[model samples]
Target: MRRYGPAVLLLLTGAAVLRISLFGDLYLRYVQAGLRPYLIVSGCALVLLAVVSAIISRRPYDDGCQGHRHGPGVAWLLTLPALALLFFPPPALGSYSAEREAAARAAQGVGTFPALPKAKVLDLTLAEFGSRAIYDSGRSLKGRTVRLTGFVTRDDDGTWYVTRLLISCCAADASTSKVEIRGVEAPPTDTWVAVTGTWHPEGRLGTDEAWPAVLDAGDVRTVPEPANPYEKR
Candidate 1:
């Protein structure tokens, strides 16, 4: 049994990876969409290696080494993650994660933002709204009714923000962007919602401060978390 430990560890780890990538939302929590192919390939390769190792372990060996060989004890640690992935896969990042990191802001002198879309009500992402509100000198958001969606967060001062995580690669590298919501009661923390409002233009611009751009919310309603929770940069 000890001689086959490495093979067992590989098999379990590979299956866990494949199970998460193929059958669940686990991949989205840790990686970007473009990485799915590589994950799948890696899972398959690990499983294949496990099979080869198992076969080799079962074969006859010379010098009385067949049953005496033992895998390094450290290899058993790999099973812990495999078991966790199978039984307790983690949820997507939420208000706790948002609270841990400082809010992201548009960089100074990011250059001119393009014109806002011509529409009665424009739908904008949290990151895009932050960029325009902070860095766009054109004030494209003035007098525009726009829609934004994100989870709710409340500050110690009783202020509320509609917050979303922006991920360039994965959750490990995720940063948050938010709009300070006014004129509506804040929903429970981490509750997803869509807010329709106009930009208030009172917040500072062109800095990386944690201050959220202000929005005067006309309407607020709870909604299901989207299939893809993190907004990609």
Candidate 2:
């Protein structure tokens, strides 16, 4: 048991990474899709290491560990996180996280953005809506109907906003963007919803330095959380 202990630990760690990255949405909570290939390769490498260690352990006299008789007792600590990840994957960033981070906005006087895509109802992420509303000199959103999906958040003054987090690399670097919703009661906090609305230029324009842009919603409906929760840059 002692000789094979390190192998068992590596096996558990590798399995946990692969399980979250391939078999479930847990990996989406930590990293973007581009990192999936590296994760899979790392997991495969760890599993291969476990197999090699186990094979060497069975040999009576092996030079792999310089014939050390002691097991990797402290190394068992590495398996704790793997066990936790397997049993209790963390939830995606939502209202609570949105509340904690400063609202992300496009820099005032930034470069021009292309005209809004033509559609009866254009679908947009909250970050895109914010950038166009706050930085686009052309006021591209002046007369367009757009749809946004995000978890619900409420302001201190009782206004509700549809919010999503933007992640450049991982959850640690995430920042939030939101659009205030008018004409509908705020949904329960953290409830994912698709809001179809037209932009209302009542708030600070040409910048979100003062407040988030407002959306005069025509329809609001609850929806399941998307498979990929964070907006990637």
Candidate 3:
């Protein structure tokens, strides 16, 4: 068994990766959708390598690793976490992740944004709303009723935010975008909600003070968490 330990570990880890990436959207919890092909390929490669290693290890060997000492067999224990992905993948990033990270991503610069559609209400992503609310020179969000959805996060002083994470590639590199929701009762942390409101402006445009934009919520309701819960940066 010791001789095959490394191969078994590799195979199990590879199976777990395939279980998440090859068969379903679960990989989205950890990485962007565009990277799915790479993940699937990697999982297949790992499984193939494990099979090859096992086959080679079982071959008749006169020397049987004659000179090289095997590393500690305890290395198999590292597979525990990897294998867990097969049965119970971790939840997507939520309120705690939003609060723990510095939520203020620097704006590229203050600029005039494109005009809003001539509609009574607009559906917007948290990042889009946050950027316009903070950095748009035209005050595009002013007087416009918009609906936004995100998970809930709160501050100690009872302030709460509708928070979402934006990732350039994956969860590890995610940055936060939050809007403080006004005129609504606080919900449990991590609960997903759709908040419809007008922009509640605070600081001057394109300034640090404008960070964590505010919303004057008109209506708030609980919603199902999205399957792909993250926004792309």
lDDT per residue, candidate 1, 79-130, as tens digits?
8888887678788899888888755544667457888879998989998998
> Candidate 2, residues 1-233: lDDT per residue as tens digits?
67787798889888888988878767888899889888889988988999999998898855676546665578667778878877787788888888987655455665578877689999998988977877676788888999999999998899999998889988898888888999988889999999999998755555556358889999999999988999986
User: TM-score for every candidate vs. truth?
Assistant: 0.88, 0.86, 0.92
**Maximum-TM-score candidate:** 3
- Tell me the TM-score of model 3: 0.92
Q: Sort all candidates by TM-score, best to worst.
A: 3, 1, 2
Per-candidate clashes come to: 0, 0, 0
- Model 3 segments more than 4 A misplaced: 61-71, 103-107
State the lDDT of candidate 3 residue by residue for 1-233, as single tens digits. Answer: 66677788789889988998988889999999999998988899889999998998787546657433355767778778877888889999887788787645566798899999989899999989988988898999999999999999999999999998989999999878889999989889999999999999988887778888999998999999887999999
Please report how far candidate 3 places residue 49 from its true position, in Å: 1.1
Candidates' C-alpha lDDT: 0.84, 0.84, 0.87
Error of 3 at 10 (Å): 1.6
Cα-based RMSD of candidate 2: 3.0
Per-residue error at 195 for model 3, in Å?
Answer: 0.8
Model 3 residue pairs with clashes? none
